[model samples]
Target: MSYLKCSGMCQLIGGLLLLLLAGCSAGESKFLAGNLNAVNHTSAAINHFSVNGYGGGNVSPFGDGGGMCCVMLPRQWLPGLKLKVEWETDPNPNVRLPALGTDAYRAAYAKHKANYQQHSTIVDLPSYETESLCSLKVHFLSCNQIKLTTACMAYGQPGYPIKEPQVMKEPAVCPK
Candidate 1:
């Protein structure tokens, strides 16, 4: 009876170890090359988004030697998907007055109200501007709508207001 119990315990431990190793290997292989059906949203306002899978070339900013951040999209989804990027303009050193009735003007007025009552002085400053930097329009040739399983990076920077992937059956409509 004692020998049987010991053998059973060993078998249990060995099976668990095998399962753990298999899980790790499966996860690693999934990201190597496959269909990607998930989208990683890094922002609360839907400003930033990424997909799993590899890009054709080296395009990842954080990639070590190769392009690890490359994401592959199905040929069908490309028809309506688009990527738009905007960048903040360089800051101006000179201070300027805020436009009246604007949020900034109201804020500054509130802060300096007491000072102005005593010293009769007003101060205003300008804020940096953001402009559209680039836009990428993607188009795919295939008409079939199918899910793609793709690989994702092992580790990546998490964006604010992260969102889970939402699967849509119909094609995406672009915003005007």
Candidate 2:
């Protein structure tokens, strides 16, 4: 049978071209949208949080909240993938506000609002590989630390990493 042949340099260039095509195609591939969940391990309750502007619902202290609509993720894991997380915390969940438009309401609202805080940070997303699902799991920790995970598994099952306390009460004070 007839055969094709090339010089060593030509063969190297050909291989490199193939690799370049693969890399470029991977870059062009569209990111898949996935659900988002938030886990709050800190003392404060999370009123809301977002990853790159995709909203995740409220979460109680030491507990997880329900899933949100979506967060976009790559079809495959890429190095240095990061997400900007923004979250609002409720320092006093049980605070009661006075009637609106009243002088007492204005004073109470301002004082109460002072305890609420919003935090933002950039966190690198961990590696995940799954064609069926690519959910973003957010974990809010003490001292304002955060972790993001992607997985198909549920929160409490095996192979899931977050293991928050089941019966712990929210602490009276939250650390800065």
Candidate No. with top TM-score: 2
How does each model score on TM-score?
0.21, 0.71
**Candidate 1 clash figure, as a count:** 10
Instruction: TM-score for candidate 2, please give it.
Output: 0.71
Cα lDDT computed for each candidate against the true fold: 0.29, 0.81
lDDT of 2: 0.81
Candidate 1 residue 28 C-alpha distance from true site, Å: 5.5
lDDT of 1 by residue, 61-82 (tens): 1121222334432323323443
Q: Which residue pairs does candidate 2 place in steric collision? A: none
In terms of lDDT, model 1 sits at: 0.29
